[model samples]
Target: MAYRKDNLRTVKQAYTEKRARALGIARARLAELHRTIPELCEIDSALAETGMKLVNAITAGAEGITERVAAIRAENEELQEARAATLRFYGYSADYTDVHYECEDCKDTGYVGTAMCACMKRALSLLSLESAGLAPLARTQRFDTFSLDYYQGDDRLTMQANLEIAKRYAASFTPASESLLFLGKTGLGKTHLSTSIAVEVIDKGYDVVYASAPTLFLSLEAQKFGRDSDIHIEEAEDADLLILDDLGTENPSPLHVNFLYRLVNTRMVSGKATIINTNLTVRELRERYTDRVASRLLGEYLVLGFVGKDVRMQKIGT
Candidate 1:
């Protein structure tokens, strides 16, 4: 599987250390067992001699190799039985000194043959997700954690409806899922619910990219206008759920505007899902961005309006 340099470095380093620790444990166990059991020393020598015999027989293409190999295996099995008995007599399990690896297929080396082990694949995905800066929200912002009690008056019911929509959107999210346009005043539950949906959409095995408008635009601009970057804007734009938080909050620039146009248009053309949370009303959006960009969003996205007193302000005395 393809991996980023940072991801490769981190995952490979961890797997290498795991292999080292596994070998270290096995060696220590064998040494202790060899010291305690005199019979084991003789059995070990005999086993080594039989292994060399098999190697020589194979190298010489010698006749009677099959019979000789069978005899050697028989001898090893007998010796293993004795070894197991010795451990059992000492009140230890048969596998007590056996090295335990997190992945039996790879023996914790992170690969079996030429393919990466499932353990390593899972680790890579999990590590990538964790390092993507969504771990904090994974704990706090979930559909279950969202409270309707935070709203009051008509704002309360509006937020309740918004919350349900967000939940359904998250539950059913896919690469071709309907894109949402979250328009509202600041401090409504827009950011909170959008972030919560992002966490769930990620859990559903989609690459969900979450970033503020400034960070998203500036980084892309830097990659384009300055040093060549390993971080690609395509990764974000092509994500399954691209949540652009706090839109229109970033400083205005032709480069930022152009990048935003490209980002939004590319996703739209590709049928990728995007959720944009902005304080700008529909009228304000048209004025802030170019008419073309505004029309694209207004035409393509499913608009969801959020209305409520600032939840943050309501929480001050509570």
Candidate 2:
């Protein structure tokens, strides 16, 4: 359950900016208060020195040290009371000088002690989704939002079973979880289900990478040729889960075929799960990608054949 290094760095930088912004605003407010009320300036200065005074009293180890510490505490409390009274006299809130953080649980630091805070986790999940290219679809293609109303009869029953399998797989996914191969025609919910799985796995804190087959192959080709590529093949191989959508849509080329085999084989060897969504059947897959790639897809991956009318078309018609 980890995020990519770059994504983590992005989130950490955001937290840094947030914390600095809060502190900066608080400092500016305090400066304004000090300028408007001379009495507040003195009170704040005295309050700041109280900490040093206590440190000195403890380190000095002189006689009557307890009495000195007690006196310091009493004086600090009195200063606070005076400060509050003075602020009220000036028609300002007593806490007007406090820094307001976005997430109080970790004070916008993105962590609580040595552990990552919930806010940070959520931030990482969202960033990961965006980086994985699933953010837009994830917003609407989650498991709960999938509709079986577009299916009917045997097709509906088969889709229902497929939906349950996808849900279970996502709920129990791990780095070493079995891979999946979604076979169906265009707009039959293959993309929707695969995206749903990716979203669920991402929300559970695992890094996921989602890319269409054509885009993935193009990026890989660019990288292979020393051109600028947004997505690295290494990221796809290293992700906890990879959702490769619209397979068999890429232009047929020996380079792409070899790259596909290598990518799938590498992830398989590394025990990472991958979900491949293709409109091609097992026979068509073999014909398109050759036996080497198709063998892995059939032998290693759990095949789910979707049966339904084009749900996207149904939606548009209705």
Candidate 3:
């Protein structure tokens, strides 16, 4: 799985800090033990010298090398025993001075040789989820957690199909994947499925950006007015998959309409995937977003219409 550059940097920094902290703690413990037990210090010093002796013996010559290495190993084993006994005699654990890593498999390095450790993958997934604005829904709104019980008859079949399509799209997502348009009323599982896709895509190591229509437009406006930086807009344009939720809910404005056109057109030209969730019907969308924006969306997007009662109300028996 590939992670975004920034996310990778963040994980690497965390690993560096973890490794340093573990080593630091171990050093502190060793210093404390040295101060308390001078005999332990002598034993550790002798054990440390064995490493150099072994290296020197190997480089010296092949003749008598095996015997020299054997002798060194015997001495090292004796010193290690002495050190452990000294620690135990002082009521300390034998491994008290050892660096205790959070993940011993990788020694908290976040990697095993050239491959990434599971710990690092999990860290990247969580960071991506948070950065994509899907952390809140990630726990309960995954594809597997989506319940077809809320839907009935044809609605259930349609939703099941949609779910399968979403899973397939996420499984094979790339920068050039097809854009999606989720047309449905509120609380019809559009947002949930979109969130599910985001979670899966992010887990697959693709950069995803999720933003509500109102929030996205407001951020764009802020950037235009010099009140905010343009990073948000850049991310929206450059993400491997961008999900704009709750379209047509933002306050109507000509400037926002123009921004919408630019955003859609830019991502389309770049071949970046985008998912737009809206309560507006096709006719209403055309009326609201003008032909320019609607044309690109209609011509290019794979539109999925969601149909079902509000799952939230069903759960509350309302």
Candidate 4:
């Protein structure tokens, strides 16, 4: 048996449970009606007999097989009408016997023919977000929770405008959209707004990876050195929305520097969506990383500057 990733496995398991529950409910309803309503049972039995007769007529080299099948079909239709009337009399809908699937397009199978259903895709997206370790933070740091009241004067107005732009960006995010750079000091809400955008993108059913710079670059370094060989993940490259949080916090090493350059260049060239949160200015970034990576990031990304007091500190004091 082929192994499935945790997210896909979770989606499959959920769909399986839903399918079983829906089918079980349907079967119980059918049994209840069959026992309580004798007319339904009789009509169903007669319909089954007619179906068998039609099949037999088709199998045998019998003449007027079409007429036999047509007559049987007409009788079956009348029986169906009687069945519907009986259910209605019992204060049940005509489709009470039918399984009420979670997703009508897939009938709870998680697929429409060979294609995956929209509901299944969303389930997988949520599972993927959980697996990315962003689910908990996403719940608390949504755009609705981000407030401009934390800032003052020019900073407050700028933050309000930035909030609108961030909302628009999240609302219409695509892999093809311009990359974003969240630039601000430590006390600012760079991480908050970045994470807010990430939550929205993930809910839109796109793959997203939100990681601190040290964690991200360290994962890359480990992958290079065979230390992280237990599971394969090239998250920054593959994610539809790659949110690299606190870019300046990572310890500098040859491995980290080279990988950062590659990650930035790869995302820029591939037109993949990326958001970088950093306390470092463009000048600082140019001095730290090579000018190529800095130029690409500055030239391509829509820069959003954040300014505010440390809300964490304020909340703590309260």
CA lDDT, every model vs. true structure: 0.78, 0.92, 0.90, 0.81
Put down candidate 4 lDDT per residue, 50-156, tens digits, no spaces.
88888887887778888877887888899899888988999999999999998899988899988888888777766766766677787778899887778889988
* Superposition error at 284 for model 2 (Å): 1.6
Cα lDDT tens digits, model 1, 212-258, are: 78777767877878756434577787677788889999766777777
For residues 1-318, could you state the per-residue lDDT of candidate 2 as single tens digits? 577888899999999999999999999999999999999999999999999999999998889899999999999999999999999999988988999999999999999999999999999989999999988999999888899999999999999999999999999999899999999999999999999898889888898999899999889889988998767788898999998999998766988889899989999999999999999888888998999999989999999999889988999999
Q: Regarding lDDT, does 3 or 4 come out ahead?
A: 3
Residue-level lDDT tens digits of model 3 in 126-179: 999888888898889888888898999999999989989999998898879999
Give model 3's clash tally.
0
- Candidate 2: where is the Cα deviation over 4 Å? 45-82, 88-91
The residue ranges of model 4 lying beyond 4 angstroms of the native Cα positions read 1-13, 24-106, 110-121, 229-233, 290-292
Question: How many steric clashes between backbone atoms does each model show?
Answer: 0, 0, 0, 0
| TM-score of each candidate structure, all chains considered together | 0.72, 0.88, 0.92, 0.71
Which residue pairs clash in candidate 2? none
Candidate ranking under TM-score, highest first, comes to 3, 2, 1, 4
Index of the highest-lDDT prediction: 2
Which of candidates 1 and 4 reaches a greater lDDT?
4
Alpha-carbon lDDT of model 2: 0.92
State in Å the error of residue 317, model 4. Answer: 3.1
Query: In model 1, which runs have C-alpha deviations exceeding 4 angstroms?
Result: 1-20, 39-95, 103-125, 228-231
The TM-score, computed over Cα atoms with residue i paired to residue i, of candidate 2 is: 0.88
